[model samples]
Target: MRILICHNRYRQRGGENLIVDSEKAMLSERGVEVIEYVRDNNEIDGYGLVKKAMLYFTTTWSKEAEREIRELCRKYKPDVAHFHNTLPLISPSAYYACKEERVTIVQTLHNYRFLCPGALLLREGGICEECIEGDFRPALRHRCYRASYIQTRAVVRMLKKHRQMGTYEKMIDLYIALTEFVRTKFIEGGIPPEKIVVKPNFLRNPPDPKYGGDYAVYVGRLSPEKGVDVLLNAWKKIKRFQLKVVGDGPQRAQLESMRVENVEFVGAVPQEDVYSFILGARFVLFPSVWYETFGTVMIEAFACGKPVVASNLGSMAEIVKDKETGFLFTAGDPDDLAARVKLLIDDPTLAIELGRNARAEFDAKYTAEKSYERLMGIYASVIREKETV
Candidate 1:
């Protein structure tokens, strides 16, 4: 089987980029031909003001991307064209290129970009669905993207144009959602229920399970949406265990200023260091305030035989069964988060039991072998459906 995978890489390396690379490698290892057409956001850094302005306007329909993709499709005659991120570089016009060439198109709904201009479905430190079923004016009014009205307007225009042209409704053959919670949200936004499928991200090589450690760890961006502030407040209440933050973001300086006792900010580290931190933790912390599309950290912790103490919201709630694989605290509530952590700290044996259960969960659902089987099934089903039509 041959697949054409296209993605617009973020300026900074992120989980989406990692997933795309991993999936491509996985398919190649399985004897499948995978061709990638990738664009990097770093290219924008070289543009002048006028060029940047032109780029924003053209984001609604990137003719250059369409031309390149059309050429590639004609040359390769791929069975499927799978897209991850498009945004300001490879626009929705690329979908039309695939459709015109008679290639099956599949899109992974990594975020709520199709439904909300902000793409995160979050505003002012809370969940905001003002534009999910409505129009994009609310997003324009709020300047949801980058806190700039012009940038937000550009994204809104792109979404509006695609909606009117039926690019999302008709061009795409299938939508891969990372979790059932995410799939449901896309359905609510406008996608047909039958066209969407749930496929969680997998660990290609999970580390061996370990039993016990001293500190608790948090392993994602230290941003407002991640609830890092809440984690700090929660840490203030706990005296028995130390907390180690494993990532960095815009909020790091402010977070460090608070100087919460017993909390160590281990800024951004290598992937190997991240695994080391997780392996040396009694439990992982994920106190996100927004509805995450999928909590990759939870599965990583489970793979390391460490249970998580996550916010009881969206995909986190769905993935981490409270009192089973890990414990869930009320979203954005520092006291509740502290209480949950206290439970594991007060009873080390309970933490061990939960870690064992967490590892069992990973073996059952999150390994590379299981993901490849499911991925192949999705691809084959889409190909067969295309043939019938």
Candidate 2:
């Protein structure tokens, strides 16, 4: 099958970018023809004042992107058009181009942008779904996006425009949600349930399971939303259990300041080194405060035969089965997180069992082979439905 993958690259590369690249490579490895048409958010930096002002309206419907995609479709005539991110770059207009060409459209819901202006159901270091539940005016009032009223207004306008245009309802065929929890939120936000499918991100090349090792691990951006503060506070309360935090972000200075006896900040490491850390760790920490659409790091830890202690809300609850594969503590609660850490440290046998189960879970549900099979099934279904229509 020939596929045309579309994406708008974020300023800082993230899980979504990795997934897109991995999926394309997977398809190619399986002997399927794949082509990518990508745009970068960095382009916005060079725009004039007038163009910057126009970005708010164009964010949801880019005529330039639509025309460009239409031209690509005319030349490539791909069997399916799979999209990752189309935020302030490609825009929702690309979907209309696919519709106009009668092509199968498959969109991956990498984040909650469609439902929340901030794209993370977060405000003031906690989970906030005010925009998803009701009026987005709260987001406007709080200046959620970049903490700028103008930026927030732009995001709100984009969301409102696409919503009114029926872009999501009419243009897209299939929506690939990374987790059941995320899928439910999309449904609650008015997306058709039948059209949404759960497909978790898979590792391109997973690390070998580490049977036993020392130190606890934390991987991902060291930002407040990631619950680094909670993790640090919990570590301070605990007497034992060495915690090694990987990855660098805005919260580095703050994290460095609160370094306890057993807590160590290793800063940003390469992706391979991250997997190595996971393989060497007894457990991985995912104490995120905000609503994570999906926690890719948890799965990575699982792939390395490491159990996780994640937040007890959002996708983390769905991913980590408490006392089974891993444990879940109340989000942003330092005492609860510390208690859970103590539980894991106190029971070595239980921790080993949970780690074993986690690796098994990864083999069963999150392997590259499984992901490819599921993706192919979705692609076939979308194509058949489009043909029938």
Candidate of highest lDDT: 1
Worst 10 residues of 2 by lDDT: 126-135
Instruction: Score each candidate by Cα lDDT.
Output: 0.92, 0.89
How far out, in Å, is residue 379 in model 1? 0.7
Query: lDDT tens digits, residues 60-168, model 2?
Result: 6799999999998888999999999898879988998988887789999999888889999899987788888547899999999999999889889888887888888
TM-score of 1: 0.99
Candidate 1: where are CA atoms >4 Å away? none
User: What residue runs in model 2 are displaced by over 4 Å at the alpha carbon?
Assistant: 48-50
Please state the error at residue 12 of candidate 2 in Å: 1.1
Instruction: State how far residue 38 of model 2 sits from its true place (Å).
Output: 0.6
TM-score of each: 0.99, 0.97
